[model samples]
Target: MTDAPRTLADAREWARVGTELVLGAVADIGDGEFDADSMLPGWTRKHLAAHVAANADALCNLVHWAATGEETPMYASAEERAAGIAKGPAMSAQELRAWLCASAVKLARGLDGLTAEQWRNKVVTAQGRTVPATELPWMRSREVCVHAADFGTGVSFSDLPAGFLTALVDEIAAKRGLTELPDGPLPEVAAWLAGRPHALADAPELGPWL
Candidate 1:
């Protein structure tokens, strides 16, 4: 079995790689396409971009929680999260892109401020699970990598790193109680399990995946 990222440094490196992929995809798109539909149902590319930007800020809240040993929830409420998602599409493409880039950088800066002890401090995830701050990088990485493809650009599961794909499959399977998956590339299998479109044939239908 592939080992999960065991240190803040390792996780940060992976997050960096994932961010690059996301930015590449975002940068390649035309402004007109921002209004176009994405792979995710009911979400336009602008919505996807907005969610991605907001997610970075949300994760930064966890970083603050870790560094200060105080309670900081990812979002104020479900309504706030929904509102944030709705707000992104209305911005000009340049504004949306700038928000995406700036939010990611802000999160990275927040993470870099954490000391070793701070990295060990517990924070509550949006799902309400309490985990160490070290997990935040992986969480951010998942959002960037998966949603980059959801943008419905040329990006696909095959574009992600093999190690990331392996860890992703394990995480999704454990969370969803999936014991078996259809035979296919690991990336495709992971994508399908995450409720994203994949080329895998006859993959079992799954319930909603976070």
Candidate 2:
């Protein structure tokens, strides 16, 4: 059977862990490393950093929409989102780090302050999927955790929580075909789901999910 959808509280805990993992990896970035290529093709570490930071701010819009009944969209438009990511690397490494951490904190606070009713408010993702506010934590958790590994630091699917990994693989697999769990442990399945190198030599080399 498919795994049950994660609860808001449980998903928020996953996001918290993932945010810390990303912050730790960012903390380890040395000079020149920001410009260094990441596991994601043609993207430097700074690109990943910028996207992660902007995502927090973008996601905050949905949190606000849920909290206030405001019609806040994740970004003004798709072009605006592209422009923001394009300009992200222009910031100094220190400035970028602060922006990422602060945005993450702000998003966390927004989620923490929501009432039960607020949590049930409907919001649309940047991808145009309509979902309840409860999905916010799961969305953010996916971003931080996946990008942490994408940064090409020590973090990998194996480093993530088993519950999250299992869910991630299941989610990605759903997109590929709404398929069932592949025969493997959560981590290996995650690596395959993430299109990263794994022990599954037969795994297909899927391109970037985004």
Candidate 3:
């Protein structure tokens, strides 16, 4: 994406686009399909949907921290996070799908309620990096978009908006300590950084960036 969303307005809009894309895929899923393996190893479609819903809940914690100046973490512990995901398989298909939709709506409402000053408040990410609250939208944007593709129902890297993909590629490139975008087309570079399949045979092995 030549003009990847950097502004707060853009980020919010793009995040919504990502949410819609993924949820549409979710909507089309037959009950039997939830047990199928997703693009992510060892995770079924149900687990993927569960994680995405839980992620919105986690981000809402950050939004609370930013809004109130309290020190709330995304997850109390990694085990707690895993335990949240572990709850998915036990849920009925309707229950899990409703949870996914509601969580996303709740998170979006929470974010929209913040004032400009609150948006600038410093907050710590799950990775322990302190960034302005503005980054939350971007974080959410990345989550829904990448995971949208991971479902492998129909949405894919190429299905994502170019600007959003470009932004994701640039952010992941910097994380890998590269000053320049990886040598490939936008979708390929984004796919590579996202730990998905890419056509770049020359790409180096990378640890998880999510």
Give TM-scores for every candidate, taking all chains together and pairing residue i with residue i: 0.94, 0.95, 0.92
Please write out the lDDT profile of model 1 over residues 5-85, one tens digit for every residue.
545665677688878888888898898888999888888989989999999999988988898877889999999999999
- Model 2, residue 147: C-alpha shift (Å): 0.4
| Models sorted by lDDT, best on top | 3, 2, 1
Candidate 3, residue 86: Cα displacement in angstroms equals 1.1
Each model's C-alpha lDDT? 0.85, 0.86, 0.87
- Model 3, span 1-210: residue lDDT tens: 343447887788789999999899888888878988888898988888999999999999999999999999999999989988888888877888999999999999999999999999999988899999999989999999999988888788888887788788777877778765557778888988878888887788676666
- Each candidate structure's count of clashing pairs: 0, 0, 2
Per-prediction CA RMSD (Å) = 1.6, 1.4, 2.0
Which regions of candidate 2 are displaced past 4 Å? 178-182
lDDT tens digits by residue: candidate 2, 31-75: 578888888888888888889999999999999999999999999
Stronger candidate by lDDT (1 vs 3): 3
